[model samples]
Target: MKLISSCWIVDPSTFEDHVALLSSARALKFEQHCPLEVIILSGFNELQLDYVEELKALNVNLNDCTDITRELFLEYRHLMQDINDYEFLCFIRWIVISRFLVNEDYVHIDADLHMQINSSDFLKLFKGLTGTFGSPCLVAEHGGDWFQAYCHYFTMLINDKSGLLQLLGDTEISLIRTNIVSDQDLINSLEKNNRLPTLLSSFNLENWSVFINPLWPYITKPSSPVGFSQNGPIDLIGGKPVLFWHLQNDFVSFLGRYYLLVDLLGSLGDEDLVVKIPKLPIPYLQMDCSLANIIFRTLDGLYRHSRSGSSRDRHKTYDPLSRLSVTQRFIHSHKGREVFSERLWWENSVFLPLNDLT
Candidate 1:
């Protein structure tokens, strides 16, 4: 199976975090009985170059990491055109999957993650599934209160390239290609078009507890055991042995929640294991009470405010045709639209109707 990830230089800490991420993936590969291939799409940064060299020096594979040079970016200029760096990175990830779809299927992982266990079961489950994609779990907004921002983790198992191509029309593809909309918005559009994959019988995707998000408050309490169990060799999370953990956002934002876990994992006696606390390049001061709350809220507001009005509307609208801008309306109209009618049929089969049936 092929595993892909993308990275751009955000900061020194991010690079360090990626190094640790690769280290963990290397460790997990040693435990795996199945064949696995890892590839990385990387941006051009001197530090990134140095980091790649360092990883190579440590015997980590650097052969598959593709550098996004200006010439290469120009070749895939359609994907890079009109998008910010974030969108550019996202589009590259899609390209990685699209170009390699002949290999049957692959998993796309975010850079800020570490594997804690052999993921053979998880990989087999994804390979056996009949769907356009398999996500860890679907999470509604605010933990199921709203559908406006419904999303699954970007770390996904994708299959059925034809279905994906049909669902993302040329215009929609352009938007995605150009990074006009986020991947979450792309999933929302899928839901709108009734193109989302359904789970196979008795094979609930949510039942697979392979990965854990310790950053979420429900799993890691400030006062509880940090991520270890006295009775077991593996770390316990949500009453199960954790296989992987995602450490997203800035180091400061995740300071309290992830520090303990990072410390525990970093302390493992294995010479092959090398988990490190990601250091932020910028100076930051710790704060408490009202000051922290205000800063966080203000940051949230600014983030929301930065998003396009159309994107905001897209998230809030359930009907595909409602409140759509002229461009959006045109994009939603495609030459050969694919759709599925029966939930059971869609769930059990991979060859969904290539024409819109809804």
Candidate 2:
């Protein structure tokens, strides 16, 4: 099976995560036997020469998208000046995929993911599945009200790029508040048009349990692998092998509080294991039974409507306060804006190619 795997590398700080991704790919049995090309679509700050050199050493291809990304952003600069660098980078993912991938199947993995099994098997599995596009993790029902369908785009396999490009359309550079409008909405739009394809099967194990007990190694426990609901968390899957851990968010400044568990994964050796839940996070536990959470959610709904005004009714925003961590909440606060401003100043001065700006 001819395959090309691609991922975006925008931040220098995520160099370790990128390294882990490469290392896991090398560990794949199929990678050793078959011809697989790894392409890193680099974004800003011109990744440290050492990191680029290391990836090249592993036979990984680097396509420095710094200038191209800037040029593309320029096309939308009239309406995009206020958005952050990451938002600009988000728009470049599908563009890079479409441009580089020739006549072959491709898998798009996020930089933060850690592979447990051979990724080639993942590609082979999905390629044979019923659908033009496939995602290993299909979060069926998610959140209350809006955003009920959580289609995880972090790990996606597509037979070709045309289906995805046709769905995304030209509204590529837009933003929802301070963040890029997520791929979930794009997938939802595809579903609305009846273009969304069947999702590939994989263990939907999240490390939410790791947050409750840092020392507990849930990977070794017995949990039912099948019978996962589309909505709600996958707290129990007895003894099922996990395909990959979606170490989901940005790891630049804040690794989730449970990130220590990811570090502990090395201790269990390389084996397909489903870690049992010691205890779920306090906030997640409260959502079902706590009066406080209910009241807080009620207040949060009011706050959303109050702040969103008419736009609240126009497009339902999916952000829920109950899901935010201390660091996430901080980044969403007024102080976060000041911090981001300083960071943006630094980025604009150092990383951004100002000469290219019009």
Q: What TM-score do all the candidates reach, one by one?
A: 0.46, 0.45
lDDT of each: 0.37, 0.37
lDDT of 1 by residue, 26-143 (tens): 4444232443343455533335566666555434334343543333566654543445666655544554434444434454455444444445554555453432222322211111
Best by TM-score: 1
Superposed by TM-score, candidate 2 places the C-alpha of residue 106 at a distance from the truth, in angstroms, of 1.0
Instruction: Provide the clashing-pair count of each candidate structure.
Output: 0, 12
Model 2: per-residue Cα lDDT over 5-114, one tens digit each: 54555555554443444454343333444434544555434567776665556545566555555565565444545445555455445555444553344555543333
Q: What is the C-alpha RMSD of each candidate to the true structure, in Å?
A: 19.3, 18.5
